[model samples]
Target: MNSFEQLKEEAVRLDAADTLAPMRGEYLFPQHDGKDVLYFTGNSLGLQPKGVKQALLQECDDWARFGVEGHMLAERPWLSYHEQFAAPSARLVGALPHEVVVMNQLTVNLHLLLTTFYRPAGKRNKILFEQKPFPSDQYAFESHAQLHGLDPAEVLVELPYSEGRTYHTTEDIERAIEGMGDELALVCFGGVNYFTGQLFDMQRITAAAHAVGAYAGFDLAHAAGNALLHLHDWKVDFACWCSYKYLNSGPGGVSGIYIYEEHTRNASLPRLAGWWGHDKASRFQMKNGFVPIPTAESWQLSNAPIMSMAVHRVALDLFDRVGMAALRAKSEQLTDFLQRVLMTVRTETGWALEVLTPSDPAARGCQLSVVLPGKDRSFVKVLAEAGVVVDWREPNVIRLAPVPMYNRFMDVLELGQLLARFAE
Candidate 1:
C-alpha cells in the first residue's frame, strides 16, 4: 500500500511527465491564507482562464475604437461573434461546425429547442426523462407538455433508477423508451447526472430513442466540456449546454446548441424568430418574411453578447489547443489516482467515505461524488476551512471534480489526505 507521502511523490512524478501539466497555469487559482487553494469544484464552476482578462480587455478596446462600426471593424466582429465559437465548440462536442451555434443561457435555449422538437399531437405526445432531472429541465419539460394542452402526467415518462442501483443503466433507459413506444415524442436527459456525476452513454441512449421514433436530445449542462461527445454521429436530434461549468467561461456565460445539419434544411420547422436569427443578407432590409438560415444559427433569437462571449472564445481556444481526447486521458488518470488514494486511505485508516461515481472509468467524467453517510454535514465546512473547494449536494454528498485542464495529480493527492484527516 502506498503511504500518503508515497502518494504525493507518485503524483509529483506523474505530473512532471504529463504533457498537459502546463495547462494548470492557464487558469487563475484562488489563494487561501497565501496558499493556492485546493479547488475541486470545476463541475460547478471552473476557474477562469488567465487569458480571460486579455480577451475581455480586447472587447473593451474594440468597442472604444470603432463605436457602432465595431460590428464590422472589431478584431472578432460583434455581429459575427457567436459564429467564432462554431468550430471550437463543435470540436469540443464532436459536432459539425454548421450544427453548433453559441447562443442564450441553458434553460432559455432548452425552451427554444423544445419548441422546435417537442410536438405533442394526438396519441404520439409523451416525453421521457430522468425522474430527478435538473429543476429547470423538469419545469421546461412539464411546461412543454402543458403548452400543447396535454396533461403533464399523461405526456411525461419519468424513468426511475432500480431500487438497488446507484444510477440509471443503458438497459433501463432503453426499456423505458421501448415500453413507451410510439407514444414517446421525445427522450431527453441531463448528459451527465448532476448530483451523482455519472456520465450517460449518449450514443446508446440516442440510438434507443430513435428506435422508438422519439427525438433524442440532451441538456448537456454537466457533460459538454466534461465528456468526449459525438452528437452528430450519435444522431442526437438536438442538444444545448451552458459554457460556465467545465468550459470555464465565467458565471452566466453564453451557451451553445447542436442541431443535426440535416434538420437545419427543414425551413418548415417552427421556431421563435428575432432580427438576429433572420437571414444576414436580407436581415438589414427589415423585410417581413422570416428567411431561416440553413444552420443552427436559425434557432438563435438574439445577437451574441460580446464581453461574455469574448471570455468563452479564449476558453474554447484552450480546448482547441490541448484537444478533448488528451484531456479525457488525463481526466481518467487523475480520477483513478484519486480513487486509489481514497481506497488506500480507507484501507490504512478505515475511513469509510463512499465513492458514488462509477468505478468504471468509461462510465464517468471528471467529477467524483463522495459521501460520508451518517457523519456530520459540517464535513464540507471543514473541507472549505482547509482550503479544499468542493460542491455539496443535498443530504450528504461532496462532489469533487479534478479537472484535467487545470487540476494536477497533486490536487487530488492533497484532497485525499484532507478527506482522510477529516474522517479522523
Candidate 2:
C-alpha cells in the first residue's frame, strides 16, 4: 500500500529476526491508554529492569531481620556491597577491577577525581573540554578553578565544533589539544555528548592529551553501556558516570568511577579522603592517618548506599549477561534504521527536519538530536500528548534514543509514521 505501510512491514520483519529482540521483555515501560508508550529517552533515563523490585525487596527484608548487624549480615553484605560492582563495571568500561569503584553521584565523583587530577601549576593551569558540556560539568570546571584560586574563564578552554557541524571531529579535537600544548593540565570530555549524541574517540583523544603532557579523563554519563569502551587499554587517566541513564539503575542511582591502575597505586596522590577509603585492615580501627586503599576504592568518601545500590546490582547483572558487544551491535543497527525512517519522513512530507547528530554510527550512540522546522515546541507537546517519551533541549532540539536493551524496530517505524502525520 503506502510507504508508511511498507515501512511497517519491514520493521516487523526486522523485529522477528533481531537476536536481542527478546530483551524487550526484561524492562518495564510507562503506559498510556492501557498500552506501552513509544519510549525513546533512554539517554536521559533508561527503563527500569523488571527484576529491580525483587532485588530491592531482598535488601529491605535483610534490613528488617537484622538492624545494625545487617552491615555484615545482609544477603549482599553492606560491608563489601560496592565490591560486587568492580568486576562488572570494569567489564563495561574495559578496565581492570582495581580501576573501578561504585560510589557517589556523578558530579560528586567528578569533583573528587578533579581534586586529585586537576592539579594546576604555573602555565599548565588549563582544563580543555568540548563546548556546551552537561551544565553540572561546566559548573564543576568553574568551581574547581575557583577552588584553585584561578579564574574559570582563564582556566577553562572549550573546544568549539566547526561552523556547520554539531559535533567535533577527533582530528579537530586532537589539533586543539596540540594547540593548547603545555598550558593544558587536563583534557576531559564526555565520552558521548548529551546533546548531539556524538561519541568522541576516547583512545585517540587520550593519546593526544598524553602526548602534550596533559592527563585525559571522561564523563561517560551518556557513553557508559551505550558505546563500546576500553578505558584501561586507552589509558584513560580517570572517568565517572551515572547509573540512571543507559545503565538503568533508577532515578538518582549511585554512580561509578575509573582510575588508571598507576594512579590508584600512587599513595601520595592528593584526595579528599574518608574512612571508607582507608585500608580495610585498619579501617574499623578508626586510625588517625588515612591509609587509602590501593585501588579506585581509595576515592570513596563513604560506605555504599544499600537501597540505591540494590537497584544498581540488578542493572549491572543484566549488562554482564548480555554484554556490551551485543548491545552495541544492536544499537548500531537500530540507530541506522531510525535514521533511514527519519529520511523517509522528510522525503514524503517535505519537512525540513535536520538530524543534528553525527551520521556515522561510530561517531554516535543510540540517540539522534533533531532540529525541526521553525524549531517549534508545539510538535514536541503533540508527541508527548500522544504518549511518546522523548527529551527536549532548550532553543530547539528533540533527542530520541532507541535503547538496544528494550526498544524495537517497530518503535522507530511508529515514530516515523507519527512524524509524517503530524507534519501533514
Candidate 3:
C-alpha cells in the first residue's frame, strides 16, 4: 500500500511489455529456492548461455574422436579454429576481422601491446592513465614501465577527477594529455571503469592522444561485450578485453586484442614473437627466423587454447545473432528504466544517490554507479540478502548493471524497492 509497492507493480507491467524479455530464457540464471534471483552483477561475471555447454562438448568430442587429427579433421577445424571466431568477435567490437585476434588473457595481451606501442624515449617516457583504473591494468602498466628501466612512480601519470566530482570529465582528460603531451608515451585507460562504471570518451581521448603524438590504447575489460565500440574507426592503436565479464565465456577465458590494420602491418613495430606469429606458408617449413604474418594474427604468441576459444566462439556467435544495434537499444532502455526508478526512490526518501556514470547514453554502457551518501557497506549487504546481486565497492558504492539481453525491467523495479526499504 506504499509507493514501493506501486513501483513494483509498475515494473511488472513494464516487464509484460518488454520485447527482449524472452531473451532471459537464453541464459542459465542462478536461482534460490524456486525463484530466479534478481541478478544485476553481469558487469563482473555474466551468466552463461544455455548453448555454451553444448558448444564446449562438441569440441571435447572432436578431441576425443580425432585426437591430433582434430587440427584439420575436426568439424570446426582446429587448424584455423580462431578464424571461425574472428569475424563475429571483430564485428562485436567494431573492427575488421583481420585487425582482431583472440589470444591470451587480458593482462597478457596488454603486456604484448605495450611491447609494440609503449615506445618510451628520453623525454617521452611517461605513460598516462585515469585515476582508479582496475588493479590489473595498473599492474601491467607498472611492470611494463619497470621492464623499460623507468620508475612507475615517476613515469606513470594518473589523471585526477574534475572539480567537485567523483568522475573525470572529457575536458579534464584532454587537458591532462595536453599538459603531458611532450613527455607522454602512451595514453591508456579503461573504456568503462570497473568500480565507478564511468565510460570515458574514447574517441576524444584517442584524438587528443594522437594530437600530442602519443599512442592511445584501451583496457576494455569492462567495456567489451557490455557496450558497442569502433576501435578501428576510432583509430585506437591497441585494445584488450577479457571474455569472462560482459562476454560471458566463463572464468579466465581467452581474451582478445585489437591492433588496427595500420598497426597490424606496421613492420617497424617491435613485438615479442613465437611460432604462432610466424607466416603460415613457412610455419611448418621449420624455418628459424621469425617471419611475422601481416595481420593481427601475427601478434599471437601461442596456439589458441581450445576450451577457452570454444566458449568465446559460442558467446560471440550469440552476440552476432542478436547484433550490437539491437542489444544497445535494449541496453539504453533497461539502464534508463533503472536510473529513473532509482532517482524516484532517492527523491521520495530524501536519500542522496550519486550516479558516477555519465548521463549521456553515448558516454556510458549498461552500468550505473550508485554512491549512497552516508551509508555503510552493510546497506549493500541488506540488498544482497533480499536476493539482489549488485557489486559493492569499498566506502559506500554499489554498482548495478541490467544487462541488455538477460535483465528485466521488473528486476530493476524490485531492486529499487529493496533499496527504498533499506533506506527506511
Query: In lDDT terms, which candidate is top?
Result: 2
lDDT of 2 at 189: 98
Candidate 3 to truth, TM:
0.96
Tell me the tens digit of each residue's lDDT in model 3 across 276-316: 99898989998799888999999998988998888888777
lDDT of 1 by residue, 1-424 (tens): 8888889999999999999989888989999899889999888898899999998999899999999999999998898889888899899899999999998899999999999999986788999887678889989999988889988988887888888877888889898889888888999999988878888898999998899888999999999888999999998999999999999999999999999889987989988998887888888998898999989998888878899899998899999999999999999999999888888778777877788888888889988888876666677788889998887887888888999998989888988887777665
Which prediction has more favorable lDDT, 1 or 2? 2
- Per-model C-alpha RMSD: 1.3, 1.4, 1.9
Please say which candidate is ahead in TM-score: 1 or 2: 2
Q: Judged by lDDT against the true structure, how good is candidate 2? A: 0.93
* C-alpha lDDT values of all predictions: 0.89, 0.93, 0.87
Task: Record all residue pairs in model 3 with backbone atoms less than 3 Å apart, i.e. clashing.
Answer: none
Tell me how far the alpha carbon of residue 303 in candidate 3 is from the true structure, in angstroms, after superposition: 0.6
Candidate 1: regions farther than 4 A off:
none
- Candidate 2 runs further than 4 Å off: none
What tens digits encode model 2's per-residue C-alpha lDDT throughout 215-307? 999999999999999999999999999999999999999999999999999999999999999999999997699999999999998988999
